[model samples]
Target: MSIGMSFGLVFGLTLFDNIAMGLPLGMGIGIAIGASLDADAKNKGKTI
Candidate 1:
């Protein structure tokens, strides 16, 4: 959702720019967030 939103915003400003900037940025952020959630779930002994 973050990636999509970023892509949409950047694309609205300049077409294709989102692919270069937003994608990697959003993916990095998403990975970080996913990792944190995974860690938290593991701490609570829950499956994601």
Candidate 2:
């Protein structure tokens, strides 16, 4: 999440010069990715 947010922040700052737009967007995308990874791990019985 942090990584995604930071990346998004940098991207937004560099391109759009916006922080509000980037932070939440990055967080949402990060959450989706985290969920997907968690589900995959659970399916394989690899989750702890």
Q: By TM-score, who's the top model here?
A: 2
Whole-model lDDT for model 1 versus the true structure?
0.66
lDDT of candidate 1 over 10-32, digit per residue (tens): 65447654456656656666677
Note the Cα lDDT for every prediction shown.
Answer: 0.66, 0.82
Best candidate, lDDT = 2
CA error at residue 32 for candidate 2, angstroms: 1.0
Model 2 steric clash pairs: none
Per-residue lDDT tens digits for candidate 2, residues 1-48, read: 887788778777887889888888788777888888899999999955
TM-score of 2: 0.78
The weakest ten consecutive residues by lDDT in model 2 span: 3-12
The alpha-carbon lDDT assigned to residue 6 of candidate 1 equals 64
Query: Predicted candidate 1: what Cα RMSD to the true structure?
Result: 4.2
